[model samples]
Target chain A: MIVAEQKPLNEIKTMIADAERVLLVGCGTCVTVCFAGGTKEVDLLATSLRMSTKLDGNGKVVDEFTVQRQCEWEYNEPLKEKLDDYDLVVSLGCGVGVQTLNEQFPQKQFVPGLNTAFMGLPTEQGVWEERCAACGNCILDKTGGICPIARCAKQLLNGPCGGSQNGVCEIESDVPCAWQLIWERANDLGQIDRLMELQPAKDWRTSRDGGPRKIVREDLRLVAHEEE
Target chain B: MTTSTNGYKVGSNLERMIRSGEFVVTGELGPPQGHHAEEIREKAALLKGYVDAVNITDNQTAIVRMSSIAAGAIVVQEGLEPIIQMTCRDRNRLAIQSDLLGAAALGCQNLLCLSGDHQSFGNHPGAKNVHDIDSMQLVQMVKNLRDENIFECGDVIKEGGPRFLVGAAVNPFGDPFEWRPYRLAKKVAAGADFVQTQLIYDIPRFKEFMKRVVDMGLHEKVAILAGVGPLKSVGMAKYMRDKVPGMIVEDRYIDGMTDAITGIEPLPPLTKRRKALKAQLQELGEDDPARAEIEAELAELAPRIKEIQAERNKNWREKGIQMCIEQIQELREVEGVAGVHIMAIEWEAAVKPITEGAGLLPRPNVGSNGSG
Candidate 1:
């Protein structure tokens, strides 16, 4: 889950104050999960904007619409017909969705109404905590199912450092030491001996270190030109 | 004009005076589920001549609460003033306006506007939500009724309509506390005449909130009724702390409750009983190392014994009435507090004594401003 929070209402209003016709578009995927840019939120934003504009004597008309997934061309294609009716598009989607909307409608202006925070999940009601870094490599099997990359303050792979006091991280008292939790889980499973093993430094090339990466399969690819 | 007020009328000069901060007492009454006109009438009879007004909640939290309009009508028929709580969660502007008109025709003069709870939080998980408008829009719609005497679509029904004394809900202790005063001001600007906040446990924070309210000039514009709900038991205190969002239960209060009781211990047996026994045996066996070693074996047995004890106490019974009375007394003494919204959820029968102990009973006919 990608967590994002909506920008303040005043800031959103100022962004499209000069536009005559405003299109409020929301994505129903990552942003929706975070309670930032979703179908319900888009409707609310549209109504609030209309009310604010009316109160300010701007008298601008705002239209609201949401796509199933704004990060894909298939979802963006549905909005093509409605693009000409509005002067500006206010996207309530995540960063990827906003970029995709801008890319698809090159002739129209696109503005983001949410700040994409991190990949997280709803830990409980109304609370979203970051859980993954999408580092392209997962080491859950060795670390007792906890993602040290996201949970650890320094993302230490070997063991907890001296800064860990009484199983709590010194960096922030509220944040538990991930390595300490790993040790406790390991001890519970009677595999405490694994802590003595010296692991080698991790390779970073598969991650963002090698620049934007892509994967392709020969069986899934189509012949150039002939496929069209 | 009929001497007997049947349908809605403008709040009587007397009711308006009470709402204008004159010396008056206000209490809230939540109607029971199903047809219990007698039950409602009984509660109203208890509050008559004691409370200046009673607020009827509108399907609080999307639950199947009795209709506020019907409850308001019952309160009116009993000759008690009714404050109708209207929420936007279950109705659009058309329905809301019509309901407002119907409530007025029923002689309900006081209006409390709220943006009803999300349907997901209610018991009926599969119910559809109708948030056609937010609280602010609803407030504006009410103001529209006051100004143009027309609905949102510009259809005039009541040309010289009876006035509605509007109120709104504010939760200062909820998460994002900084937003409370601002939201209150927005509601005021949208035409809320008074504000009733969510239940407050921490009085110091409530004072700080009062200061903010003063700074924002909201205190001058709207009468704020402090909300107070007496803690019923230790288990309830813990539940509110962990389960309820935006509620902060003070440690001192919890500690006080734990210490007040005698013959009953507060600690879990595993940590308390075993540790005490181990310490006592250590003192006695300090001279002989082997004797001390023997005591260590018993230390291991302590945990098993403690577990059995814990299982036995799991079904132990306790009473909560005395604790609730103490909490009520403590809340009433908080400084800068104007009044309380006694929420005795399911314990409404105890409200009269709680209010009486707090010296909140015997409300005056007129408000502090002497304008009703």
Candidate 2:
């Protein structure tokens, strides 16, 4: 899931300083799971913005609204009615959600309330860790299902670089070297021999490093256009 | 992989050595942790005439030091080829490529691409890591710049790309042993012209890795320089083994140090000897000449003990030098091995002797051979 963190109060306040009214938009998907840009976050931020602006004597009218999934156009269709009621829309969601809101209402300007982090799952309560880089070429089968591209500090395809000491990365306190974990896991699974296969230099054409990525499912495309 | 025999666009003596097919010897130089320009010059001066190329480490262990480019430039001024080490721990892709260009402009032709130690290990624990690409990509990026005359972002270099004899780091002793060689093959496939592995203390495992490397015919594809360094002290050896990561230190090596001192019939430590002598003197009567005899013997034993410990210290130092000589000799016979990368860590003074003792002295004179 895509994770995000809400922008600091000062930055958000500065971004909406000139606006007289504001709308805080939240996502109900990945952001909620990561405790970043969920409904509760949106409410909390909206209240803070109102309080800050009120304290500053700006007298701005702040409002809160959330959609089931801000990335989908259907879930954001209701926002068309509330367009003229606010000067700016603050999206408390992933970057995709903010872009979606902007595309849904082309005339209104939207600002991101949160910074998108990565695509990962929560490893524990309130602790999220990245598991995939969306590199489009997955080698998890060879690495015993551990994603070095996402987890290793170096993103080394073949790693446990010299910096891995005592099964932990040199990066921080006990951040297990992803390659160390992969090595041990592969050893435990009795699939250590599979790692001997040389993984080629990854074709970056499928990754964001090459360009902005896109996905298309021909089978799911609209079969026919509506009557124009 | 297109093993480039077309010769380097900007060549160095190290490239010449690789081209000449003579066993090469390179040594690492970690610039001072602070910005003292003269320190690099001093190190480069000490190493200039003794090594084929001097590798200037880039903030090794993530502690910010004089930039490798700056240090390498200093080494260049000292009349030695410098292998400018670049790491992905701190820089993004843009900065990495830009820095490579700058390094090339400074006449750094040999490049050692590494995924540097994590920043948390440095003084700045809270700094965000910027591993925009791994060392594999860094190698590919160097190749891309040299071969394609373009950046990783596909931007053309108005002034031609930097030609580099690229090297990458490999670990032969790390777990899932069989994968070690395959990883080497991947680095070669990514355009690594040569490789220098992590500090190797486990000779048997390294020998096995070399055998696998030879079996795969990787030696024919790329030059492999085995890493060797002197263990200055027992504490140093223990720290590297018990604390340092990716280091393989067998118990026998540590036990060897303990055995050296323990082999002697151990004398009672000074405090114990003094207390025992005092009690014995009180039992005999305070004025006895025998008490003076015991005191004289106790005083004499201190000097003898000191001499024994001094001899033991010399033995350990010689033992360290001997260990390096044996490792290098074994590596010289290992099929698929090209040379040795002497990593003295902070012990730069040992490099000349290690190289000289290993019979790698009077550095080869393949000076800037620009031919294919």
Candidate 3:
């Protein structure tokens, strides 16, 4: 899931400071699961903004709304009815949600209230750790399901680079070394020899190095276009 | 020993010495932070005859310094063979290959491919690192460029490719300690002609690693040069032991460094005594007998303390060099060890004394014995 966290209160306040009326838009999708832009958070942010603005002598009308999924245009169609009522829309959803609101309602100004962190899940009760780099090509099978691209500080394929000491990365004492985990996992599976084989340089063409990516499912297209 | 039809691969002096079955020695020369070419020349002058080759580090520890190839060119001009260290942290494949070609054109005959120290450890922590290829793939890439006459992208080189005696680093002391030897074998399979290990202070652990490597018959596949460096002080020994990742500085070395400073007052005590005496003299009458006595003691103690400090500093360095020499001698006895890579970073002059003290002076000239 795409994990995101809300921007600082002061920074969010600055974003909507110029507008007389502000709507705090929350998403019910990934951000909601992560407790970032859920309906509850939107209500809290709206109340904080109302109180803070009142205290600063420039109290403005602050309202709150939640969409089922702000990333989809249809799910965000309900926001259309409430769009003109507010001068500014601050999205507490992931980056994708902010862009969707902008494209759906071009005339209304939209600003991000959350920073999209990474594609990950809550490892513990409240902590989240990144698990995927979305590098397009995956080599998790070779590395015993651990992703060095996302976990290792250097993204080293032929690792763990000399920095792995006592099962932790040199970057920090708490961060477990990815390659060390891979090695131990491989050892447990009796596939240690697999790591001995030289893993060649990764072809990064499928990754972001190839530029912004898009997937077109020709079979799933309802309206087929003529061939060029 | 492997040799090409015309000469050894790349015909480098380091390769020649290694191939000719002579115990070789390579020294390290760290480029200055500023563009001081003469600094490189002066350091190279210290290592010229004592070592088979000198390794010019590529912004080692992620600190910005003169480029390795540029410093290596200076070493070449100073009548020394240079093994230009190239790290993957700073360059992508395009820049790496381009720099190799440039390095070769500049008369750099050897290459040491490294996964550079993380940029976060350096001055420019904000700079983005470009580890487009790791060291293993880099070794293979260099081999492909030299042997197959092809670029990493499979484009044929119309003319000459960079012919280098390629090398890589290993950390026998690295974690998952059992896997370190196999890592070296991987490098060998990746086409590394020579290997220099991380600094070895724990000799027993290194011997265990080498035993495994020898058991695998990896010694026959690649020339392994043991990395050794002098510990400047007890603080340096402790830093290497506690702070440096993958480096295992035994407690004995720490004890040795500490012992070097034994019986030498740390100057603060002498200075404190002088301060008290001066205060006492100031409070007393101008012509007092005690004032003259205190003045005489102060005059003698100041110069004596300076000499003591100088003596202490010299003892620390001597102990450092002595320890390095002892390690070199011991490493020479290891079955799989090919040579010693003396990395006297910043203290280049120590290379001479370390080499000379180890009885590795009068380095073998393998120039004419390329086995054509």
Candidate 4:
């Protein structure tokens, strides 16, 4: 799941500083799971914005709403009508959600309320850590499921760097060395043979560096939306 | 051994010592985070006659500091060999290559290629990490530039390239302890002329790592320096044990200091007070009238305990240096161990005495051999 964090109250306030009427939209999917831009968060942000704007005598009217998933067109169709009632729309969603909303409602001004962090899960309550780089190509099978692309500081395909100390990364003690985790898991599975194989230079063309990527599933796509 | 290597000026004694099969002694200088050339010159001078070469650290621990190249040049002025440490932390390949050339032009012959400590570890936690390439590739690239006269992108160098006796670091106690040796092997294969490992207080683990290196014939390919440094104090020991990544400060070593200071027969006063407070809290069940008083006393006891430990640690400087000397002696017995890299961070004054006590004085004169 994509994890995001709400921007600082002051920063968010500045984004909507000149707006007299605003619609705050939250994503119920990834943002909700991480407690960033969920329905609850949207209400909280709306209440705070109202109080802060009132305190500043900004004369702003803030309205709040949440969609099932802001990244999907159908989930956001309901907001098309509500967006026209506000001078601006503040979206509390991951990067994908916010971008998708902007693309769908091109005429409506959308200010992001949350900073999309990364694609990861909550390791524990209130703590979400990045675990995947969405590199398009995955090597989890060879690495005992630990993604070096996301975990290792340098994302070296081979193994741990010299900075790894006592199962911890030299970067910080709180984080585990990704290669250490991979080696231990691989060792336990008796898969040292696979682990020993030096991963060749990755073709980064498959990653975001290659450019904007899109998925086309002929089998799943609706015939009406097929390319001309 | 008493000549130039790979067609470049030695400009340093450390490279000659490594080539001559003499156990090389090296130390690191964390260039002060300021612009005072005297500060660096003073630190370099302290290490001049004691160590074969001194490494000038590059923004170590990610804190901003004077450039290692600048400091290395200062060390050169002070008549000491400098190993300018370069990291892939803040620079892209272009910037990295440019700095390498600049350092070598300044007469720093030895270069320690490292994928520097992450920026989050330093003052600028929010800074972007520009590790355009890992240390392995950096080592390979430096080797290619020096040996093949080509850049990583295969551009031929019109001017002569750097002739660095490439160095890299290893962590014997890094995760999955077993892979530590293999990682060192990869470093050697990648063209590291020498390797200085992370500080090793766990003698058994270091011995195991060295044995593995010998078994793999890695020792013949590169000189392996076991990292060792002073603990300074019991608090420093505890900090390394608790905080430093990949550091292995043995329990026995910590216990040795504690036992030496005060016999283990009696519980520490703080521990006793803490236990007593816990007992009182449990009895009071959060509703007792005396709970507030106990809490207040508990807070007071903590600082008193710290004061006691600090007092004991006041005499730990000698103990720390003695332990370092002992570790060096122990390395002499370990096969495939070339020497030690003393990292006396901010404790530069101790190097002159520590090296003298370890019988490493009269530092080998490799400087002349590398000077063309």
Candidate 3 lDDT, A98-208, residue by residue in tens:
998998899998999999999998999899999999999989999999999999888888868898899988878889999999999999999998898888888998899
> Under CAPRI classification, how is model 1 graded?
incorrect
lDDT of 1 at B291: 61
TM-score for each of the candidates: 0.52, 0.68, 0.92, 0.81
Candidate closer to the true structure by DockQ (higher is better), 1 or 4: 4
Clashing pairs in 3: none
Q: After TM-score superposition, what is the CA distance of residue B83 in candidate 4 from its true location, in Å?
A: 1.0
Query: What tens-digit string does per-residue lDDT give for candidate 4 at B176-260?
Result: 7788777777777777988998888999988988889899999988988888888776778899888877677898768656655
Cα displacement (angstroms), candidate 2, residue A217, comes to 14
TM-score-better candidate, 2 vs 3: 3
Off by over 4 Å in 3: B1-5, B266-308, B368-372
The most accurate candidate by TM-score is 3
Q: How well does model 1 score by local distance difference test?
A: 0.70
TM-score of chain A of each: 0.89, 0.94, 0.97, 0.95
Clashes of each: 15, 1, 0, 6
The 0-to-1 C-alpha lDDT of every candidate, in the order given, reads: 0.70, 0.81, 0.90, 0.83
Q: Identify the runs in model 2 with alpha carbons over 4 angstroms from their true place.
A: A1-129, A132-146, A157-160, A163-228, B1-10, B155-159, B259-316, B368-372
lDDT (tens digit, per residue) of candidate 2 on B310-352:
7767767677777887789988898888998988787777777
Model 4 regions more than 4 Å off = A6-20, A32-61, A64-78, A103-107, A122-128, A136-142, A162-174, A188-228, B1-12, B255-314, B370-372
